[model samples]
Target chain A: MSETPLLAVHDLVKHFPLGGGVLSKARAWVRAVDGVSFNVKRGESFGLVGESGCGKTTLGRLILQLIDPTGGSLEFEGQDYTKLSRADMRFMRQRMQIIFQDPYSSLDPRMKVDSIITEPLRATRRVSRAKRREVAVELLERVGLQAVDLDKYPHEFSGGQRQRIGIARALCVRPELIVADEPVSALDVSIQAQIINMMEDLKEDFNLSYIFISHDLSVVEHICDRIAVMYLGAIFELAPTESFSVAPRHPYTRSLLMAVPQPDPHARAKPLSLEGDVPSPIDPPPGCTFHPRCQHTFERCRKERPALVEVTPNHYVACWLHQKGGGKGEPLCE
Target chain B: MEKLLEIDNLSVQFHTPEGVARAVDGVGFDLHRGEILGLVGESGCGKTVTALSILRLISSPPGRIRADRILFEGRNLLDLDAEDLRQIRGQEISMIFQEPLTSLNPVLPIGRQVAEPLMVHRGVTKREAYEEAALWLDHVKIPAARERLNDYPHQLSGGMRQRVMIAMAVVCRPKLLIADEPTTALDVTIQSQILYLILKLKEELGMSVLLITHNLGVVAQMASRVAIMYAGEVVEEAGVMDIFDRPFHPYTQGLLKAMPRLGDRVGRRAGRLNGIAGTVPPLTKVMPGCKFADRCPHMFTLCKEKPPGLFALSDGQHARCWLKDYPERRKAHV
Candidate 1:
């Protein structure tokens, strides 16, 4: 692998304004994604994992520039993407693509399968109509579809087949980096494995890099090389996939891992219970967002927020426990 | 163990324009008193249809449900009148659906919606029902339950709404609780919390539970015994430990192997997940032989010729495969 990342995101921030009217000014902003940074290396799969309303999806969109970030810098292949103009961004679309979560709603019902796969090339006018049709046929076959399915609409296919079409569409332009946001969450368990295996095969065949976003830790652990665990709106742990699974640093990460129910019935259920629900992103807690639910919290966590620091060679954690002489000074509990 | 509910030769079919779809094909199962029976299957495998059939909830214009007997507490539910069924639905058997937002009434307050079951079934006053509802919400671990009573369904978060749904389901103190993918829509932390709440309530109330889910992990954790469904048939029925330790059916083995575990990537490079070879056959495409024969790696000519019946194994475990009937063939193959 190369030292230079295929895509780099730095200090990304996205805030949605709430409760603004003609007579009243804007009250506050919902900090959906706040100061998140990560990188996707060439031919590697990077994962973003978190619970619902934790801004993982928002971070994925920020990288794709689907919705403009309030503040951030995105670099792709040594060029700044956030600084690109409208025309230049349109041209950049061919190199970066997205496969959405829900296959049922992502595809158009009126359009044929062939047209859906070749829409990117059609929009950009990069290829002739005859050539686009030929490319679509090839992509359909590559995704385990037949030529007979080219003329059928999305409604004619099942959930797994529809997801295959979604993948074929994403691969139509031969993008270097693909952002797959919860791609197999909607499918059944067996079908999810099928899609994940197909994705791994395609990545190796095409030499593609991916930014996979999902809430399932096991699925992410199976595919990603590096994983980042997000909380309310910020990342608290980042490490290699093996390290993250075997020796998670952050309390939130450990809790999440213990919370997962294993398939083995003989395995004992560990009671690493959190106190309450996730705090609202609109009115986040004062200091550390996870302090309310964290069991190893201290008085310092209520007054000061910790920054992400390298605890080991490649493992980073944003918790007071890893700080130098941090948790040792405080008492065991409140 | 005493039998709480018994379903014998239950079949459900839908008369669509395309063809007659056999959703559930002669399914049979028994639930013991105060036990949790998990029905595990993928979508279109008839788990949901089987649950809905227990309460006679299927819409009957295009749907038809037939059964030899659906015995509950010495009374056949299939032979009950509408008034009797209505009286038994909320008072003796209640159901919690997958999506709480849609299952709840959007126009009414959460408190009133939860109290409705109590008022209708127990003939309690509105004020008394409301007071009990508040207590129920608090029992489900909802904070400030009394104050949050007047809030509408849309106002509460997904996790809160699910808690409200649980309160509603248990308000009347039913003998059986049918939770169909109850925690599927929630996050991992919230999902564990909900499962724990259900377990706690089940023990306190001593009620039998029918847990319907596609997730093997949830089944392994919550159910004492499980029934594995495939293509509208129960292919394997066994104790949860036996199912995990020694899955006899090919479909069950494929499902367990296909799932990616948490620490599976600790010392190995990322590789393709083991997936089933083919997609599930459509419901309309009925065949006389085993529905899984096409995808089964151990399929023989007998599997394509005739469907196998349940063969008993040790510890009351059963699997529907010809290999169990003819042990010599299995030895020859090995």
Candidate 2:
């Protein structure tokens, strides 16, 4: 725990071009991941949760240098990765692999399971042909897949089995930091638990650190030690899993917890439904991005942006309602 | 206490290259007027299929429905031909899906999309339909609905698109509305907005709702009653509070135990979630016993010998499990 952060991101930003032109241009930038900062401690599972277009997945890709950041500083194991040369970044990537959301699309249908896993070992120059096969089989076994499954294609397997193959490939290079972007979202719910359990066991066995990204809070709550709730490319709340879930400071976080359908009959009577749509990312609202839909929004919220300040000793939140002098939680406006 | 919708001995099958996949089998339930019934299960547990079957929307030869009856407003929808079904589809019963993007027409404006249902089902004139559409949009809490009428589906945010979907579904004031994972695709804040909109509309129209979803948190917040399904069957059905407080079926117990909630001190102390092991069995395979037997912790020989029928419990609670058959094994509480 005392070891330096395995990955530290400072002011990370990613903006996609929204429109095009030849002579004159009418364009806007979709601010996917904007000015976000976080640190993933070694061997710790840090979760990044937001809605579909909230930029969590983009941030994961940016961290692994899979895509270039619009702006940010990235340091991996004290080594500045943002400034790394193309070849250096490529070599460094072997130590920081990623598992995508859709295992069906992520795996090459043309290739066999053995070849898929061996591909990483080959790319990293980590093993010879004979050893790669042996290692691939072992990796498959590690992810609860059988050695015989190595000969099958991605489409040949079921969704759960395909996800296991995807996991086996990610583990082939023995990456210290794995960016698993909604790895279980595509699988069946029953299978989601199995994979999450396997990932937890694998983390302990391999001493791995993960930047797990997802919108499903329940799954994230089960796997992550710490969680960062993001909105419109920026972090709204970051805290320990237990604390964040119980007494969420951010209005958005509270609304999120309230939004999840609990199985209890009593819970359904008075749902705290959020008020409005999220403003477009192409031109996110000024000040607080969430202010537009926030129940506790004030005139101050619309005019001034809040900083991610420490609310508790460890918990951080970026909302005017939770300002040091303001208050602790969202109170209904009279 | 009249039933708004009644499903009897419902079953659905899809023919694939491998074999005939029996999706939903012998599912029966009743939705009281203005009541919100949550149909919950993991993926492939037939929750969505059950909803689709109620609408008689299962695609042709490859897909077949063997339901004894789907009574809506005292009419057996199973016996209705295409024309009769079409008339009732949006007028008597409406449906909303997980992804609003796919459900909406990309080429059409928001106003047109909303108006389509009004014109089709209610036979309103174009101008009248447009006016009605604007009002419905405003009803769903889309600000400046008149000005935003011309905007295409892509122009609005995810939450707005979902609102449009809801507005269209309820435009004709259907007696029963089926929302299949409506908010699962949106962010938590947006999800809340949509759920809130649905709740408001249900109250206003006095329409019953059947919400099909894998998210238990949503069921707790939205459902008045819950039907917990597993591998083509309803394992448990109870009042929402009873399902949460005194879950009788082992599958229901596992699903509850697996979820991570706010202020879950016991969950954190345990460190590991109660993960259900193994993937859902393929629908093509015929099982002689309880579908969840392989995953159940308290499985006995009887569990594997024959599937249990729905056993009545106090307070309208019911569950299908061999454990329930033995009076001694029935615990007084969850």
Q: Which prediction has the highest TM-score against the true structure?
A: 1
- Give one digit per residue, the lDDT tens place, for model 1 in A107-212: 9999999899999888766788889889988999999899889999999998889999999999988899999999999988888999999999899898899999
- Candidate 2 scores a chain A TM-score of 0.94
CAPRI verdict on model 2?
acceptable
Worst 10-residue lDDT window for candidate 2 chain B reads: B262-271
| Residue-wise C-alpha lDDT for candidate 2, range A20-77, written one tens digit per residue | 7677564888999989988899889999998778899889989988888889799998
Query: Which tens-of-lDDT digit does each residue in B252-292 have in candidate 1?
Result: 98899889888889888866677888888989997888889
On a 0 to 1 TM-score scale, where does candidate 1 land against the true structure?
Answer: 0.97
Mark the 10 consecutive residues where model 1 chain B has the least summed lDDT.
B325-334
Show model 2 residue runs off by greater than 4 Å.
A1-3, A20-26, A268-274, A294-304, A320-334, B265-270, B327-334
Question: What tens digits encode model 2's per-residue C-alpha lDDT throughout B178-207?
Answer: 999998877775676677778888899999
Report how far off residue B169 is in candidate 2 (Å): 1.6
Candidate 2 structure, TM-score to reference: 0.91
